[model samples]
Target: MSPLVHSGPRAPLRWAACTCSRDPAFVVDPAVQLVFKHQGGYATLERVEDGGTSAHEKNEPRFRPYDGRVHGVLYRVTREDFEKLAKREGGYVVQELQVQTYDDSQYNALVFVSNPLFKLPQEVIPTEKYLARVREGARDNYLDPAYQAFLSGINTVPGAGLGSEYYNTPSKYMGYSFLVIAALITLAFFFQH
Candidate 1:
C-alpha cells in the first residue's frame, strides 16, 4: 500500500518521513523522500463519497469538508524524533500504521491520530500558507502525476502559506543537520500559534 492515503475527493496524502535533516531521506520504496512534515495533523478539506458516517458517528471525529483538502505529510524521522512528535500538543497520539505500496509491499510506519478526548471546539481549517508548502514538497519529491494535478487543482489561499524559509542553511552540513530544523519548526508552530 502506498504510504499515501487518498480518502476521497481530496489531494492525495502521503506519509513522508520528517526530519530536521538538511538533506532528503532516501526512501527507495515509495519513490519519494520527505523534506518536512510541518503540519502533522491540523485539518484540511476532503471529499467523502457514500455520505460517510461512522456507526458511532457521535463518538468519532466530525467531518468538515472544505473547498480543498488539508495537506498532511509524514516526515520520516528517527525514533528519537518520533518520540518528540508523540509529545506534540493537540493530543496527537502516534501509532504504527501499515502502509501499502503499489507493488503490494507493506511498510510499517508511524501515524499521528488526533485524540478523541481533546477535540477542537472549532473547525480545523488549514491556513493557505501551510497547504502550499505541502504541495510544494509533494511536487519536489516527484510524487504521482495525477496526485500532483489534484494538488494543483485544489483551491488555495492566496498568500496563505508560511512565506519565510522554514530553515536557511548551507548544504555542506546536510548529513548532520536533518533533525535540527524539523524539531524547531514543529515546536514553533505548535507552541507559537
Candidate 2:
C-alpha cells in the first residue's frame, strides 16, 4: 500500500488484506522500505477544470520516478484485487518492486508508478486536505518519525475556494445575478397580478 496517500487509517480508500472471508478489508501491514525503479517521487498538478480554470488542482497527487525512495505499508492482496486496483489507478503504471520490512525480510511487490506518457509541465503545492491524508497514512503505518515530521512540515496551498476564487468569482457572481433576476421577475409578475 502507498504510504504517501493510501496506507493510513484516514485513507480515502481501504485495501483488503486478503481474499479470505475472515480477513478484514482494512488492514495495515508492517512498514516496509521500497526501492522504486528510477527513484520515485511525489507531486501534484493544478487540476484544470472547464474553461481552463484550476479549481480542483491542488488536491490531486501523482507518483513518478525522480530521486527518492518511497516508504510504504505491505499488504498481501489477491490477484483479482490487484487487477482491480490497477484498473482504478488509471494514470499509473504497475511496477514489480523489491520491498524490505523492518525485520529485514524482503519480498517482491507490485507498486503503482505514474505513467511516463503523462508528464506535468510543473508541479503545484498540494492542498492541506490532501497532505493530511498523506500525513495520516505515514503516522498510522508507523513510518520513520523523521519522515513523518517531514511530511508534517510540507507546505500546502489553499483549497479550491481560496486558491481558485479569483478564477471562479466572475462565474459565481454571474450565476447569482441570474438567480436575482429570476426572483425579481417572479416578484414583478406576482405584484402585477
- lDDT on C-alpha atoms for all candidate structures: 0.40, 0.48
Each model's Cα RMSD: 15.8, 12.3
Worst 10 residues of 1 by lDDT: 29-38
lDDT of 1 by residue, 70-133 (tens): 2233344567655544564344455554454434444565655444433233332334665566
lDDT by residue (1-193, candidate 2, tens digit) is 2334443565433544333221111112222222111111233222233444232232333333222234556667667766766776755677666666656667776667545443333343556776677678677667766666656655676565533322232334566899999999999999999
User: Once model 2 is optimally superposed onto the true structure by TM-score, how far is the C-alpha of residue 137 displaced, in angstroms?
Assistant: 0.8
Please give the lDDT score at residue 34 for candidate 1. Answer: 17
Q: Report the Cα lDDT for candidate 2.
A: 0.48
- Candidate 1's C-alpha runs over 4 A off are 1-41, 44-76, 102-104, 117-125, 157-193
Query: Which whole-number lDDT from 0 to 100 does residue 64 have in model 2?
Result: 31
Model 2 misses residue 189 by how many Å? 47
